[model samples]
Target: MGRHVFLRIVDVVSNFDPYFQQRFDAVRRKGLSHLQKCTAAMCMLAYGISADDVDDYVRIGESTAVEALKKFVSNINTLFEGEYLRKPNENDVQRLLQMGEARDFPGMMGSIDCMHWQWKNCPKAWKGMFMSGHKGVATIILEAVASSDLWI
Candidate 1:
């Protein structure tokens, strides 16, 4: 992610939960920054790194990193789900329709596409069902509908 995007996410998370906001520890003389905690969690989840491995760069204990990840996910679900992951409403549909009409595809507001995503966490037994031997990778296919501004 770009610096701006990362900071924006951090900003949202910090606002949602004070735990993700950087803090000073006057008593212990040290405190972990939210960036450290969040970076550690992102590395673990995005790269499949072990919790202990996150300590090398972030200097966060495994338990603390895990806790941060848990809290981060919980707070994201609480704060952003309403806006990013919502079913399209009537007003949204009307806008989509207008865009489609301009393109000469009246009454067609959205299109569907099927995509295959690598399933990094696919179970062993389920691999046979989802894996494509030709691609030599385990993948799950999903069909999604997208309009100009939203994915549903």
Candidate 2:
């Protein structure tokens, strides 16, 4: 991510949970910047990387990276659960059915789909998780359900 976008994410995260704020620890150098912590956490989650793997790139310790991951998940659950992660209700289902009809997919309330991606740079031990075939390349597949009105 670009510096601006990363900073924007750190800003949002810090606003949601002040634990991401930059601060000095008791006996060490000043703590990692919120940007570093957030970036490390994002990398670990996005790539399913081990905490130790983020140390060199993000200049964070393994333990701190893990801590950041835990806190980041907690804060996201706390801050955004209500609006973005909510389940669709009856009205949303009705609207989706209408949209499907207009789109010539009658009776379909929502669409379900999946995407497969190669994980070429994945770490050796982690490749098994994404390995789905004998191609010797790791891969991941993402599945989602959504409609014109909501992701549900």
Candidate 3:
């Protein structure tokens, strides 16, 4: 993400939730900054890493990282639900259908696709369940339907 966009998100989230604000520990030493908390949350989201994994990079413990991520997501949803995360309305559906038809995809509202990503940290117990038979590697499948305008 661009720096401006990231900073904008950080600002909005920090304003919405005091949890993102910097605080001092019992020893009066400053705890994590807003940047650190937001970075920890963003790293887990962008990399799909476990909360524990962000500890090494973001210097946040697993539980704290998880808390930050949850609060971040909740704050974003609450703050931007109407503008950025709304369900498609009738007009949106019609527009999507029209766009699809214009591209010769009659009756299609959007294009659907799926990709498999190797699960680098797949648990040993579930490895076999997610393993691809041909490639013999554990993977997770991600699927999305996006309009021609790239709205997913």
Candidate 4:
């Protein structure tokens, strides 16, 4: 990975505790450190790379790629709840609005957009959910903030 990209990711995730550490400590009575697994998953998500590409790019086995992806999704799901779908509260939304107003973009609670990404060799069964934008390619769903510029 490029130094800038690595540093940026480190900055994003450095404050959050890894879910695996808590689980490992509780169950095994010892922490299981798999920095490779965490880094591979982060790289794949951040870059929107496929598992096979991540395996090759990160120099890890394909099995590790699959496991990392699974663990990443599982851990994230555990942190979210309810029908609002992990949205910020009223106070947080107000703060964001104030921030946007200060930045001269008012009335923007948030910005929503989508992108179509090419998915070569996609399985037939999963094509429907991924199609978008003149059917050009598979689409990965993304949502982000306009003020803070955070991806969710």
Candidate 5:
């Protein structure tokens, strides 16, 4: 992600949840900044890394990183769901259809894509079914549709 976009997300999420705000420890020293917490959360989500792995670079504790990830996802959903995570309306569908027609892909309103998401806690029985041949890890396939604007 670009710096500005990442910062914008941090700004929005921090404003939505005080948990992202910097605080003071018992010694009156400043605690982790919003960027650190958010970066830790983002690293885990984007890179499919474990919370323990986040500490190596983001300098966050495993438990705290888990908490930050939970809060970050929850707040982002609560704050932006209505605007960015909703199903498209009639107007949106029409616009996308027209755009697709212009590009010679009639009736295609958006593009669909899939990615393998690591399933860290897969059950033993299910691991065989979920395992990815190339990655050699248990995973779940996540599918998404996005318009030209990259809204998923």
Candidate 6:
């Protein structure tokens, strides 16, 4: 089951740009390969696996799993800043609005929604940020443009 899940994740990530692979290569030279660390971190994040349970799931030491999770987050933040998550200019916003209008949905600059994600072990200091609606453990914000047909 673990192997199947890991392979499925690999398939999904493989479709992303090669930037992630290149960054992984650089990180791999320092000792732990990116695949190992990323797989462990993703397992925890996606499957709600506790830090203690990661060892049983991924065959790594508990300490190593913790370190991998930390490194995964740090590396992702660095790469996100480098590759994506840019500040949009006025022109870009206007272009997006125009595109939305072209699709017959004027005045709909964008759509906003939130998804609830389970939080396994949130810290007390950061619980508020992760709070969600009833039966929701955590939330993630999502925004995208909608077309006249309600397609996004």
Q: In model 2, what is the error at residue 60, expressed in angstroms?
A: 0.6
lDDT of 1 by residue, 48-112 (tens): 77788889978999899899889877877787778775777898889889988988999998888
Ranking by lDDT: 5, 3, 2, 1, 4, 6
TM per model?
Answer: 0.78, 0.70, 0.74, 0.53, 0.79, 0.58
Q: Candidate 5, residues 1-152: lDDT per residue as tens digits?
A: 99999999999998888899999999999988999999999998887788999999988899999999999999889988888878888998899999889989999988999999888867799988988784899988999988887767
Query: Candidate 5: where is the Cα deviation over 4 Å?
Result: 114-137, 146-152
Q: Put down candidate 4 lDDT per residue, 5-112, tens digits, no spaces.
A: 655544434334454342354456744335556677877776767777876666767776777678765655554344224778787688878877887889666676
Q: Which candidate number maximizes lDDT?
A: 5
What is the number of backbone collisions in each predicted candidate, taken in the order shown? 0, 0, 0, 0, 0, 0
Q: Model 6 Cα RMSD, Å?
A: 7.1
**Could you tell me how far off, in angstroms, the CA of residue 88 lies in candidate 2 after the best superposition?**
1.4
Task: Give the distance in Å from residue 106's predicted Cα in candidate 2 to where it truly belongs.
Answer: 2.8
Pairwise lDDT winner, candidates 4 and 6: 4
Flag the better candidate by lDDT, 1 or 3. Answer: 3
How high is the CA lDDT of each candidate model? 0.81, 0.83, 0.90, 0.62, 0.91, 0.62
Tell me how far the alpha carbon of residue 50 in candidate 6 is from the true structure, in angstroms, after superposition. 2.0
Q: Ten-residue segment with the worst summed lDDT in candidate 4?
A: 14-23
Off by more than 4 A, model 1: 24-26, 123-137, 149-152
* Candidate 3 lDDT trough over 10 residues, lowest sum: 131-140
Cα lDDT of model 6 by residue, 44-130, tens digit: 877868777877766767887887677666655654554344665676568767877987877556665555556656777877887
Q: What is the lDDT of residue 123 in candidate 1?
A: 81
- Give candidate 6's TM-score: 0.58
Q: Over the stretch 1-152, how does candidate 3's per-residue lDDT look in tens digits? A: 99999999999999888999999989999999999999999998888899988989989899999999999999999999987788888998999989989999888999899988887777899998998764788988888889978898
**Candidate 6 deviant stretches above 4 angstroms:** 1-33, 116-120, 124-152
Clashes of 6: 0
